[model samples]
Target: MSKTSLSLALATALAGIVSMPAAIAGTPSGAFSIFKNCPYTNPSVTTCLYNVVSSGSFVIGNTTLPITSPITLQGGLESVGPSPLYDAVGAPTLASVPAKVPGGLLGIANPAPDWPFPLWVAFWSIVNSVNDVTATIELVDTVQTNFLQALYPPAPDSGEDPVAARLTVRVHLQNPFLGGTCYIGSPQNPIRINLQTATTNPPPPNQPISGEPGNSYYVWVDEANYVGYIQDDDNSLVDNSFAVPGASGCGNVALGLPIITSVLDFLVSGAVNLKVGLPSAAGKNTAIMSGDTSLAASAYVLASEQ
Candidate 1:
């Protein structure tokens, strides 16, 4: 082939290479999300509890909960509180708290009298930054009871009662800039959500309750981070976000009350060596400042992994 023809062929190959699709970017460090299957299980009653606990870590920006370098398990279920609807029934009427369940296990049980009413567990984590997130969830039925036991001694039970239930996991990426404001707009609010019901064990006719065994659900967010931004000028604003004063600064801030608010003034100005923005800053920060800030507890569940 002539030199001119060879040059033309090379140019064509270069053009094709340039037109190739660009590679997807990786999730930044310190940003992560959760994962699980729908219709979770009661850790105390299910044998597959290990599956939920063993799934994986929460990934934030570039730092992942349960870090790898030092093998630190930094993040886990802080506190699985009752769903908002259940909270209205009063704390005493709610299901038993999963105090016994370890941080690793994402399951819990409802004590007696409650009859295991459907509940929602809140989970939170703080990485270095924020990013878009995705999650995985799984559900499995593990136990069943005799629905007719109330009528007769043995109830002359028949086949297993069908266990039908769905799992709904909602993920909220709190923005520290908006004073821990939750990512709320329309559909982008929840980072991950899975709704599912048990497909097996069809309910018996005229039966008020299905005597099917309990089921376990697992949901996880493999990738997560912050993409939106707020216009503000406050370096103390965490993560380059806003630095809300008091508890109303960010909508998603999850700092519990009483302790933090009690000593706000003292910690911030008194002889204490308080530094704003730091995790410990909670104790010293004032909970009375202005701007848009919601109590941390109202925003995300930021507590010990128990």
Candidate 2:
């Protein structure tokens, strides 16, 4: 069959399980409580509000208010409760160095606070006011792992290590809003992002071959990963209007890119195949596998409806 004919047949077969729909913005239930001239102090009050938002519940007080969007909170909001906990935005630099080694066995880095996970809820401004809002919450990783591994490879036996690997999660908001972007820090580590391996670099034999010398190994993280979210706590909820040209959500008032959460990983080994998996709350978890070679790797946001 011709390439076009083959492509058409394949698409028809896949249509049973896959559906293509345009992204839709989420609507708020008319149950939010509004206070007039109320001071935003009281940790208990904030905690209550956070619980309502997180639990998908709401209570509106005596006021003539229109529920423009769902009440939402990002990172964490402080409340009146004793010893209130907060969510962390970006990954903080390691006060001390983690374990390091040469080729063969390898250690995957821990997830950064800013690294996008499955359960993260992203918010964007629709009215520019703190009250007017839109939210894009994701409970799963949308990026595919196989695609990422194909694009960037991990370490190789006696080969160079990956310079870096990054994952970015974006939330598209439909309205314009001011002071609507907020980040939360988790009191307990609530998210898990990790990499798993299939084959490790082979260890040297007790006795070296007469002609072959024992190989040495080393791993190095990409400088970009270090600067992107690790070294800099520059987590931001950017306006869609200011997105890079020719990129997603540019010059479109109907859509705004609020949160950009990312993570980077570096590895050193001779192994040809490696797989990485992000923490998930539902569906078949996704994974990326590095076939062979040593180079930078990356995964974009997993696209899904709220």
Candidate 3:
């Protein structure tokens, strides 16, 4: 088959499971989000080198978003390795630094008010905003469009496609390990993204800003096994447009996860495979993660509407 025919065929096969007239994007069409760890070609070599790069498409009514590629124009699953988090503030000196997180992350309980998981905001494609950074308020990590494409003769698909609405969740957080100086204290910790893995603790409680409260904080012990958490303090679930972009009418747009899970794992899957999370941290969760950020630990992927 020619490249054009092969592209159409691939699009059909993928979208075939979701709706009809697969190649064309139509009412309630499907949208995709892909994360890849490509350091050689990505722009943010500092972050991209260590972090997962993201890209996807929005299947608007009747017309699939035009994919840009020299090869066939059809989205395909990614096959890349997962990257680690890092600090982006190494400018004027070096590139970036490793985040200083706490150690012994086995089965930690709710370590709230100190280090709450952040809502990872992202978009399938930039519609109104100039870039994802400005539009989503979340620091841009991986940026790409038409992120995936297929060649003629076709190939088998890899990765698992889980249910998602249109949301982004960044389980990584900023907190002081011991107390003194907070490593991820900087707003939007562009310096480093420390998780539950550090050689030493921060210091003690009550040093100043970024100090650990009660000389303690919270973190995901085993994100890979621990499902997820949607607690009361996590304000990211609420619909407050004034606070979050594209969240004006979306009241309490958040994902309900059971037993605080690791955002690292989620990002790992989203980045390595041809999958995406609904109500992306930057997108609206009017349907899925809507209402309150408070919910018992649960495992559910609110699929988007067709």
Candidate 4:
């Protein structure tokens, strides 16, 4: 079959599974079952994407959290422009599902202070008991993301390797002690993570790091049709030069008492920043997402809808 015909056939098969029907929200079956979340109704959408970050580590300043839970990223890419700007308009559908920060608050670099003081000692004692605290990195804005940059391998450049999957994110710290509003970064002052699937050249204090696109192979929808390719396990997205803001609103809540809540918020925020090394410099932090990625044409997805 010709490239155009093959592309259409491949997209048709993939889209058949992804954009089956708006009425069908249940689980999808078959080889293309993984793309169940593709937004078929969106006319502007031109690409279907599903990626799972199985294992990786995010090092922020003094803390290093291993990815225990899988991080899922799924949605459609709009036919806005070219390359990375394809999703720049028409209400982009890409969504980055936040994953838990492994060990939660206990996973931080320094859970307790070295020198035991009066107020600090009391704080640490209480914090140590609150083992349910967990942190999750959430995307602050989808517009700040670059899908193409993350999807394709980087090219050799005379200049620095640009950030891949460039995203603005905030870390939500959840715990009774920290409160629901507690966050390491905010929408206004988010942590900008510039991930890349290539070698990084960060500033001082951070050494260079590398990433890979992993094994690539095309999917066969059937004997006569060829679907989009899949980036199997081993794909790595890395960045070691992103700044992290300090924690805020920690323990900030009106739990029947105003004074107690204010005090708790202050104490918790201070402790978290001090231990996690908040407001860290660009070179002091790192993020690596390793997973499998599947892609299909949006045209086919929409065609399947009809």
Candidate 5:
């Protein structure tokens, strides 16, 4: 089985242990609950979308993090065609959801041989409390015009897909040892993921990978809404050309202690970056987001709330 599959299969086992909270919670009542986060209130917002990334893998440097938990992206678009070039939502649209990375630090499960002995002592001391490490992908910023590409992707040139979405994001590495502020990238220097629906054209070392637009369909929330049908369905976004920055602020909390906090921070950050290949260059990393998407008129979504 794939790492994602295996992680899912073994998720129950981790349940007995302390695990991170599930992603995308609190479903509101109504058929359009899936699009609950849609910005229907914005008069300029005409299109709303809801996407659930089911299974995929994110490789940063040397560490391979499988997406066992689903990550959701939802919001609305002011214009379909980039003519006007409206944003998805005035506020951040991408949900800050955590996808647990199996095997904790160094991809090693707890209670391993010589647990907390020798070199494993510092490693286990930090992550032991969290049970497992969780990586949360949070959006830092994005181009408003890129939203249209997800719906009407441009044709591929040669064999490579055109850029679909330009997303600037940071990965939050959460564990008791790393503390609450540990992160791979920050808002000022974020990882930019330029996604496409067709075959990718990576830099070097990495090979080209393909993605699908998936099937498209329409849905009518209510016949009385008198709005155009929602154009939405499944799609896959792939990118292997983005770079990943080194982690920072790890083990810099009160938990890391006072005098040795700086040392712990330096040790934890250095170990993680070295082991995971921090500051990975473009073409050395990969991200595949496979999920279903729905697009509905803001009026239709607003009407559904009634």
Candidate 6:
């Protein structure tokens, strides 16, 4: 017998089949957007997810390289997290708050019999100083898979699968400044985001490769070098190109809500792009690949004044 998870109310809601919320008057109802895959009231159709693959070439100084295996990403269905789409800066904190987040929320879930998906939070920064962009990305893979996983059940299953390696490079702005140093994590560290059903991601690479999910990475621009790069925990460089950020004194998240809107949202309001066939120090744009990661999310405007 599989152990049933979710409260009776939540399960009832799931059984009821909740439809996408309708759009507001002038707010441009987001209901019909791309995020309709994960509906709060229905779990059968919750197949929303994402993958990371190399798309094309990225040039830096005089070097370029092809994207290979070992660098990847995958989430949705089996992986989940707090992705509450907010327009504020410094939303989540990195301190004691993590203990407060719902556990086992960022990976594939069994749903019943056994919910072994432990609670975890992914904290990384996508900084693009060249283009002046930064995002304290927090992907809380809810481990909320389909009810079928639970129904069939796996013997001591972690409930997570290999989501192809993912890496998204966007040329944009920077994060909110504080006291002289800056970092990602909106509202505050250990923030809670998985408020509703969301499923959005960058397009897969034009080709194929291998990698895993539930990994960590961070990218930033070298002001001294005036270029972008991806770095792993070992301080190893991942990519030759990355997005840039708007510099310090670049303004901040909002003074206290309404009056001050975060540039993080405003800057990202633009497109996440990729380019190929650029000059490089490697004689060839070897850094160029045929894959890309869409670090995007689906959201709906519940209420609007307009």
In terms of lDDT, the best-performing candidate is 5
**Candidate 5's residue-wise lDDT over 217-242, tens digit each?**
44433334333334445678899999
RMSD of each: 26.3, 27.1, 24.6, 5.6, 12.3, 22.6
Models sorted by TM-score, best on top: 5, 4, 6, 1, 3, 2
Q: How should the candidates be ordered by lDDT, best one leading?
A: 5, 4, 6, 3, 2, 1
Report the C-alpha displacement of residue 144, candidate 4, in angstroms: 5.0
Cα lDDT of model 2 by residue, 1-306, tens digit: 232432333233223213323323232111111111111232322221121111111011111112233322211213211222233123211111111111111111122345333212221122122323232322122211221121223335536332121122222222221122211111122212222222222122211111101111112222222200001011111011111111022112123323332211111000101111222122222222111211110110001112
lDDT of 3 by residue, 1-306 (tens): 343542343333333334322232212112211112112122222111111112222221111221121111111112211222222222211111122222211011122232224422211111123221101112334322111111111122423221111122222222221112211112342212221111112223212111110111112222343322122221111111111111111111223323133443333222211121222331221110111111111011111112
* Model 1 segments more than 4 A misplaced: 1-88, 92-163, 166-169, 184-306
lDDT of 1 by residue, 1-306 (tens): 232432333233223333333433332122111101111122221111001121123222212232111110111111121121111011121111111112111211111232112111111222124222211211111112211121111222445322111122221222321122221111322112111111211122211211211221112111121111111111010111111122112222233323243242232221111111122211121111011101111111111011
Residue 239, candidate 5: how far off, in angstroms?
A: 0.4
Q: For model 5, state the Cα shift of residue 46 in Å.
A: 1.5
Q: How many backbone clashes does candidate 2 have?
A: 32
Q: Candidate 3, which segments miss by more than 4 Å at Cα?
A: 1-23, 30-137, 143-189, 194-306
The residue-level lDDT of candidate 2 at 134 comes to 32
TM per model? Answer: 0.17, 0.15, 0.16, 0.75, 0.76, 0.18
Point out the worst 10-residue segment of candidate 5 by lDDT: 12-21
Q: Identify the candidate with maximal TM-score.
A: 5
lDDT of 4 at 113: 47
> Which portions of model 4 show Cα errors greater than 4 Å?
1-29, 79-129, 143-152, 158-161, 227-229, 252-263, 302-306
TM-score of 3: 0.16
